[model samples]
Target: MTTIYLVRHGQTYFNRYNRMQGWSDSPLTENGVKDAKRVGEVFKNIKFAYAASSDANRARNTAQIILDYNLANPPKLVEIPNFRECFYGYFEGMNSPETWLLTAHQAGYRTFNDLVTNFDLDYAKDLMHQADPFHEAETADQYWQRLDKAFEFLAKQVSFTSSDPVLLVTHGTTIRSIVGRYSSEKQFDLTDPPRNGSITTIEMNQNRQIKVKDYNKLKI
Candidate 1:
């Protein structure tokens, strides 16, 4: 079986400012550095045969930091754009609260919380894909197709017989999509998002059987 550990990038300045940060770039906050370090510590003992990250700097840097602390010889990092966060289009870099107000209004929601209550947190993502007035954001199918191809590429590079697991550092939405689509656990919910720097473990067999061993585990 091939084991893969998926990690969400640490918090960023945009995350702290409540901004819509898809495709837009931002540096990690001080707390974000600490969070990545903590994740590194937690996985320090595990040797990774393969490692990768989204082309985005936040995810790439987080992956580098974790590998820095890895006791085992870390493999060369593969940076790929296929694992990038969903593009927010016109909403990129906008204050999330204000953006939500506009989105909620367009969706006939009285308030942002109402939208969340009605459609769950994914309402924002739904709006980005389905209701954006500009219609520039990627559709759900597009996003899934991108990730599907990315995973297929990664799986081809991974050997099922390897003892060391593979590691992938990516954004929240990307990680969430994978978990929601592949995890078999009954208790895992798509609406319950993973915290920054959280680790999710998945295993795939030669027969193409995929199993999520752990989902969104924040601590060791």
Candidate 2:
């Protein structure tokens, strides 16, 4: 079985500004760097077989910092475009509250949280896709397609079959959406964004079966 550690990237300028960050690049904030370093320290002893991050600068930088803190030889960091966050199109980089308000109202939701939590989060993602005027935002299907491809890339790696754990640093929404979709454990708080530099652990067998052992943890 392959142990996967899904890490949310550190806080970014967009996160501090409360802006929509999907598929939108942003630099890490001072707090972001510190938090990532803290996470690195927390994981300093755990040896990782492979380390990778999304193509986004925020994700890549966070993974780099964590690898730098590794006590053992850290694997080379790979940048995967398939691991990128969902495309928000017109909503990208907009004020997060304003964007959610627009989508919520258009979807006949009295509040933004109501829209996202009414059904599953994937349904909410489809709702957001529908809300985009440019019609370019990723739908549930598109997001899943990309995610499936990302998994394929991992499975292709020879070291992924080994017992050593692997690290994947990506965006907040990407991590949440993945957990919501695949994790059998439904007790997690999906409404709130995961803490910066938090780790979510998933176990995957050679059969490609995935199981979430934990979510949103500061340390393993």
Candidate 3:
């Protein structure tokens, strides 16, 4: 079996402002740095064999900070661009969550409340499709494909037979995609997105069947 630790990057200015970050590359907030340090402390005793993170600076910084705190001698850090947040296209930097919600409703989507009340695969796909009519944004399928590829790449790079744990630090969307792939679920709960500085763990058998041992443990 292989143990995989998936961590979401710390909070950012965009996160606090409720913006559509996508590939915006915002710097971490002061609170974010503090949160990252706390996350590092939480895993201070755990040693990982390999560490990987999204190419985004937020994720990369989080991985480095965690390693600096935890491992006496950190393993090599690999950058994986595939583990990035879902691209929001032209909507990037937008902070109008309410406008988006209204747009979804106008498009005949179940109301935002209804969508939240009934978060399922069909609902998720509909939201993605309705959100970006021009197809400039990443579709649900594209998001899942990137996540699936990242996991397959990780599995190939790591020694499944070894006991050492592998760490993956990435964005909330990327992490959600990972969970969706493993669970084979079509619709994802809005709550499924991990908060900044949160960690989730999964255990996988040799056959590559994954079991989510823990989900969304936040480090304050």
Best model per lDDT: 2
> Candidate 1 at 216: error in angstroms?
1.8
Worst 10-residue stretch by lDDT in candidate 2? 107-116
Predicted candidate 2 versus true structure: per-residue lDDT over 70-116, tens digit per residue: 99888999998999998998999999888888878766775556865
Tens digits of per-residue lDDT for model 1 on 80-147? 78999988888889887787777777778755567645764455566765656688877777777887
Please report, in order, the local distance difference test score of every candidate based on alpha carbons. 0.81, 0.86, 0.74
How far residue 53's Cα lies from its native spot in candidate 3, in Å, is 0.5
TM-score (all chains, Cα) for each model: 0.87, 0.95, 0.86
Model 2 residue pairs with clashes: none
lDDT (C-alpha) at residue 92 in model 1: 89
Cα RMSD for candidates in order: 2.6, 1.4, 3.0
Question: 1 or 2: which has the higher lDDT?
Answer: 2
Residue runs of model 3 more than 4 Å from their true location after superposition: 106-116, 121-126, 184-192
User: Candidate 1: where are CA atoms >4 Å away?
Assistant: 104-126, 184-186, 206-209
Q: Give the lDDT of residue 122 in candidate 2.
A: 78
